[model samples]
Target chain A: MKHWKKILFWGLAISLGLVISLAPMPVKATSSNQKLFKIQASRFAFSPAVLAVNPGDQVTIELVSQDVVHGLSIDGYDLHLVADPGQTASMTFTAGQAGSYTLRCSETCGAMHPFMVGKLQVGGNDLLWRAAGLALLAVIAGVWWKRV
Target chain B: MFAPGESRLNLARLRVLDKLIKSRWPLLLARSITLAGFVFTILVGLLGSPVGSHNFAIIFVWIAWWTALKLFFIPLGGRSWCSVCPLPMPGEWLQNGSLLTKAQKSIGLGMRWPRRLRGNWLASGLFLLIGIFSALTLTDARLTAWILLGLLGTAMLLSLIFERRAFCSYVCPIGGFTGIYAKTAPLEVRVIDSDICKSHAEKTCYTHCPWGVYPLAMRDSSQCGLCMECLRVCTYDNISLNLRPFGSDLGQTNSITRLDETLLALVMLSSALSFSAVFIGPWGWLKSAAYDVGSTAWWAYTGAYLALSLLVLPGLYTLAVWWSQKTGQAKAPFKRLLADYSQALLPLGLFTWIAFTIDFAFPKFSYVLQVLSDPFGWGWNLVGTSGVSLPSALLGAAPVLQVGAVVVGLFWSANLSQRLVAKQVQPARARRAILPLAGFSLLFSLTMLLLLLG
Candidate 1:
């Protein structure tokens, strides 16, 4: 490799490493005791698209279908239920996972049924941070392997 | 440090693989089975319930076949799927005027294909158009049926008008990207020795290759459809199906580069990102905009989609290339550098597609079983699995898999970029040229990670 190319390669690699390692840690808030939320499902959307709660919180959800029959299925949780039009279904569970889980429509309601999605954010979401760190490590290791 | 052509394992030397490749019946049988499946999918889509999840047309085509092509086929077999793809079968049969036997003469009009339409521009444009309307095609059973029927009809028409496999070569949208990514696949069709090919009087392999690729001068896997035509026609037994390292073609400098293919690569990467956002992301308005085709919001969405795929992504890549050249003090032409560096995107593009596939397919895999029992959603339980609803247990591991995919793709691309630069400039200048390209790959990987994990 040419002199400038080698310098730029190592320089960028080190800078990337420092930036990732020195990045501020994600804020972890204290756990809340209890929370109750009502989520509404319509033709192809959820009213409360994002529901954020602390880990270990006792959460109660009232899901209502507005226009048609729709089902709510949340990833990382065994919560799958269908609600008919103008009907409300109730469920309660303790939020234990510290990550973001997708809440999607289980039933095929319309042409956009596959894309009807929401997010359930619980606690600190350490997984995202860990993933970022792993990605940086993988890049550094890859560059090093090429050099070797 | 390693040289090209260092590690290639010939499958022709293997007893069973050789037997299968040399035989006429195995490929025919595979193509026949897929043809039956293709007919079944189209029929069910046209005649079954409009509900996508309950219908076999939607479930089998979108969930099962799409997943298989992305997750397994392209990664392991390259354009091996094209060997058995049913789309070109009817056209080939009609053109040859034979079902199982090789014809002494083809039966087409033999009109020469338009010279300007020779590249992947049409395929890329068609692919972008399809991506623009994927919201409807993936969900509406009737629309899916129409698209499939349209592809089959076009293939037949083109075969009748022109000579060999024009649809597969430059018209099919699916073939466009598959051919590009197939270059990264470990499997390749190549000659055992170029010396024999050079001295041979008759070029039987070139004449028989349906995809218009000559095995003697074949340096890349992009054009070879793995149809096994060359293997049969090589009287000297010079052709061999080899298992090679992944991204081997991308690392070499001898391969021809085209702007359309490079744009296709960026389009694929952008499409993957856009698909994840529209389908998997928690965005309701985006979904509504995408689904409502003629609405004002849909037009806005389309504008944004085109801008992102055609302009923004390529603009960013151009900037990286410009920076690399400026910083490295290299004197290579701008267009040449642009094309060469664009090849580095293939690894990342393919793996990002796999990541997206894992996210989309792994969750709804049980639907495959449901549709198997009740194809038309008519309450018939033919296979006793109509009521089964197995949840996606792989959800927890999905993020990790996606991260691994993007990360692996980034590093592989970075390595290839470095190799590419080294071939053009001095060692130090090559390192400088590689830096910006590496940074670009890292940035793209980080963006993908954010989309996937965040």
Candidate 2:
């Protein structure tokens, strides 16, 4: 409970947390490039479920419905597309936001309609890595609190 | 620094609070309201739209009630929901032969729950049964209604056969869920003084408790339903509702741990992991398999699910406990030690569910509003805001929040594990003894993180 020690531990914690969150990831980006994804939407899934792209890249998606009616909406971005069976709809947008966005089925497909989702990885998914860092810090802090 | 659940701020000292708890009117009123809601949910589930999101029974029951149970009720108000739970209300009314008072002409066989069937095995088994088919139950509105009907029927049947709240004590999975996690909530109902009880002739609290928990014998908040019957019935003014720190009943070395309760905790943990995989992960084939019950793929899914819950997780936890015992060289019997230490898993398991709620429930919350306006999805928009389908408000913060919640749980469990080992092992070996348990917690946390956000 000493103020100095507590401050020191927290200082280290905050610094480590910031570093983990903001530090350029090893796989972040070599160069910005155009990215295109032809995503197939079925009853409850998107083929190539995860789409990886660099931040600031021009990203275009060609959404194709394999069966039934399906739609794709990217979370954190105002982009949506719907297609009928054996039809194609496309949308083009710049991948301006970094981190991960979930791709959800906008249309009510079937039983597992709510759960049909994919991931849009813009950069290195720094949030997850930062969270992992913070988790480690939480354990250290917990153990340290008990010890001191 | 102090005894578990010992640090007290007696909430009963507040006059308004005292009155609220003492009166039967408030509890009766609350239970009546929930009973109405429960009946309405069953009706809507049976007669409303088949779609999960658009149905009141599906959205309100699963999304709203289930989420609230995990995030708020169990964590903040231990067994408080049980105090006003409508599932037992119908039977309780029949038992009392009145709405808000004990009738002279009571109804029931007044038989005791079999000692052989005592403990949480039935509750955990019921939870496993429900979880095995969660994909269907969670999605199909009719199935949800049928399940609710079945639960109500059983509660009523047990009330007539067994004495007091036997369905709640030994049957309801939801009750079991709350009872175990209620240990971490910072509230408890206990006697102000034990000598007062000993000096008194009539033990009103024990005689009146619906859950059959004797107030003086109660060591934790696990069994107490917070009914306040004891609080009201006691003339000596001996019962006190105290506010204490979290983890108050957790990891106390002196308390005896029931194998059933420990197994319940493990089952809950396994179920959380399973839920994350089946519900949150983007595995369409797996989801379809789980939903398509009785198919070869579904049988495969059930096998894997059973193996994980009944065998893998428990086996792994046992191995970890055995390692801790070997390294610490503690003399306690293996099952006793396992049960005792399993209390550490409470926060871990609870937080996993909380994070799961964040992922599974938070995004679909708009559906709560949607269903409110259109309960049956029969095109009658009562609120005029029916067409509004806003995306997740927590879209950006959900992952960060989920991660924070999970790690905090791991931190709590890790800290508790260390303390539990320190009580048994020498200070020099305490860290080593706790390593296995710590590793187990970390592994569980990481797996959840993977399923939730990876």
Candidate 3:
């Protein structure tokens, strides 16, 4: 209700709008991090199960489905990419943080499609500090509740 | 100020806005606009246009209705949306051209059917079940599609049975939410010239009420849907819709009297709590149980889910009261007070649910993207070519935001209990309500934190 609060609210709203609308693109020099990764969406394997990338590094993923069409959804991130059979699908996004994440198959590919999962780990991001803060808060609350 | 069934009321002497609303044109205008909007939404859904379902306009309609009902209804106008609801489209159609009218009239099921068992919690309960199922199964798109289909079926089936737009008024969780919140809206239809109503022998409004509610007993805002049907049927031009302050009826006695409404309030609160706990928990086990096929440990998982949903949360409040009584505390009935307290959280829970839908559900699976891709003639791309790695910091903040929501919800419940008990108990007794409420909120939050940590 305060003037400053209104301004801050609008500022945050605008930034959120921009983030949701704009697709993540290569920000740094493209050639420096131009490594292509092949992800074959076959029966039970995703070829290279583990992918390693660096912060601010641009990488292309070429995906082809050997059997049925499979969707790749990443938890904790806004990525809704899908691949179809025979046709190759590709998209470029920067691996902007350091953490292990599951690239779960969203589309019902087959009987074991639910188990068709892959991993991605990025290096160089201050994720540790935030995780620590969460842990610290939990610890403090636990102690306080016990004392009560 | 008029008592039940009092024909000579002093409502008209109160204002000039009454004189303007006595006109029939206003009633027609309001009904037409509402009907247009309702028809448009249904048509758009039937067209199966992703843009209509996915675009901002549809979301805005639901959000605006919710916001208006919550902010305006409790303090202002009651049962006002009922005046403008376009639910009896099928009934209206049947009256116009259907050959079944003769058979319907001849059969004469009549009004003698007992009104006591008229309201059912199962309608709202089914709605809640569907909502939970949708949340667990798929995100927004599938859920929205399912809701649209369900509405079509409800409209079709309800038109045939129980007579006169009964399903929407007596059933429908969404309608119940609107009816409850409409208590806070700022405008209402009242008898402007009671002298005319008194002089006229025929009570047309009573007979014409689409939902079969007696117009004379509609002094309370809770049962009134603000349909202005009474206004249209009044041959003497006695009925008038007038603008007034919000929550004007809150302090007034004889507000809402139905036990079914109390049941509805309980259902709303429980559904909200169940949704928050199940979807936003900190236990990896819950997620595993939900998403992982083999994680189902049969009875243990099923029992825990049932106990948590139906018993544990509600039981905690009951237990608190038992504790209070054991400590030699004299007070009001705990069950009734808990019911009222939980109902107060309905608005706050609705707000959080909307936020969750927007924050987590909307951005994830968008039908709009799928439709837009169709123009390029690329049918379905079902493979993940791009790696997914959102920052942990952002992902980690979600559980905390959810915790904040739960805390706010609990405090609101506590405040409602205090208000309800103000007349029956001392301030100390009223304050006792906060302890149990806050404890439950904290417990739920910590359980969620553990779920997230896993």
Estimated TM-score for each candidate: 0.93, 0.96, 0.56
lDDT score, candidate 2, position A52:
92
Location of the lowest summed lDDT over 10 successive residues in candidate 2 chain B? B1-10
Which candidate, 1 or 2, has the higher DockQ?
Answer: 2
- For model 2, which pairs clash? none
Error of 3 at B78 (Å): 8.2
lDDT of 1 by residue, B1-454 (tens): 1126459888888889889989879999999999999999999999998988888998888889988999888998889889999999998898888886548887889677899998788998998899899888888899999999999999999998998889998999989999999989999888877999999888899877888788878767888899888998899998888888887778665445578888889999899988888877777788888888899998998999999999999999999999988877666687778888888899989988888888888778778998999998888899999888766455778876886687778777877888777777777777667778888778887777777767
TM-score of chain A of each: 0.72, 0.87, 0.59
lDDT of 3 by residue, B1-454 (tens): 3435543334444555455345545655676787676555444433432432232223333334444554344334456555555555544445323321223342212333246545545555655555444333332333344565566467546655455666666666667766655544455556665666666777888766656665554554555666556765677766655555543333222333444554555455555444433444322344334433334442345455456545665577556545544332545455544444444434344434433433333222233334333311134333431223234345435434543444344334344434443444555564453445435434543443333222
True interface contacts reproduced, per candidate: 0.51, 0.41, 0.03
TM-score of 3: 0.56
lDDT of 2 by residue, B280-315 (tens): 888888888889999998899988988998999999
List the candidates ranked by DockQ, beginning with the highest: 2, 1, 3
Deviating ranges (above 4 Å) for candidate 3: A1-148, B1-87, B92-108, B128-161, B184-203, B214-216, B234-259, B273-306, B321-331, B364-411, B438-454
For the predicted complex of model 3, DockQ is 0.06
Better of 1 and 3 by TM-score: 1
